[model samples]
Target: MNSQKCYALLIEKPKTFEESERYCETIGGTLVSFSSENEFKILKGRHSKKKFWIGLKQVNEDWEWMDTTAIVYSQWKERNVTRDVFKDQKCMFVSGTGDWHRENCEKKLYFLCKFNRMRLT
Candidate 1:
């Protein structure tokens, strides 16, 4: 496996969750997913003050990432109230304040793509 670090691209144009996912795939990546708090903080610092879709969505009764990683860490705006509010809003996004919120998957919004390119050893 390639040991190169994952990188991200912030797409300014707004798109629905599916649209954003397709766009990222065309460029050989997937929507961004947070694997750790430090990674999230680093990206949050660079992409602060902007709302962007992340690779998280509810599937059945559980939320998961586009990359198929198990959902671990989350930055929900209101952790206590999210479960009730997330009934209809299945997709997750990072708000301008770097807090996460759920919304309709069809709602248009900017998105971030995560990728790891191969490197010659």
Candidate 2:
């Protein structure tokens, strides 16, 4: 089994969500998805005070990862109030403090991408 882990790449340049997604794909990766608080913390520890795009988006009133994987975890801020305001805000981004927030997908921002490490075998 390929037990290699995945790692993230923080592209400092600002780009719209669609552009960012394409960029990651060109490099053999997809936008970063956080499945646990630990993964979020590690990302937070690496980046400084900057907003970065993640892999979460609202589709038909449901939140889903860009890769179409089940959303097993979330770190959304103002969770209770977000549902009401999320109608116009479909794309998700991570704040400096590691909390998640919704934004327009057209807004350009730094983005995070995840690629699996290849086994050296």
Candidate 3:
């Protein structure tokens, strides 16, 4: 649990959703997800009313979290998993309320990045 300070990164640029996701991975965070009320509050308070890019991707038009590497858990802005317009898209974002939404992976948006405990490997 002793991880280095993980700063929430805000990326406001026009890039593919995949690109955004990859950018966070490169830095250490994997897009922001509201898994708990506290986390939701923290991110919400920190970001206020801005939307940011996340690391969720749509495979075969289905939404999934790239961080979890599984489908059992969902951490997104929207409850509905299917997006007609975003089906082909492969990136997600965090709305002001800490909800997830599918948008153009290449669209410009503020982003939230997370830094986890450095791996011991």
lDDT of each residue in 2-113, candidate 2, tens digit only? 1344756556679998899899889898898876777678777888687899978877867789878678778888646356656678899988877788898999999988
Q: Could you tell me every candidate's TM-score relative to the true structure?
A: 0.87, 0.86, 0.67
Which candidate do you rate higher for TM-score, 1 or 3? Answer: 1
Model 2 bad stretches (over 4 Å): 1-3, 81-84
In candidate 2, list every pair of residues with a backbone clash: none
Worst 10-residue lDDT window, candidate 2: 1-10
Global local distance difference test of model 2:
0.80
Q: Higher-TM-score candidate among 2 and 3? A: 2
- Listed per model in order, the count of residue pairs whose N, CA or C atoms clash below 3 Å is 0, 0, 12
TM-score of 3: 0.67
Cα lDDT listed for each candidate: 0.84, 0.80, 0.63
- Clashing residue pairs for model 1: none
Tens digits of per-residue lDDT for model 1, 1-121: 1234566655667999999999999989999888788889888888788888999988888788999987778898866634765688989999999899889999999898888867769
lDDT of 3 by residue, 1-121 (tens): 1134355665556455666677888876777544556555665676677877766677675666676644443456566656465465566676776666777666778777777766577
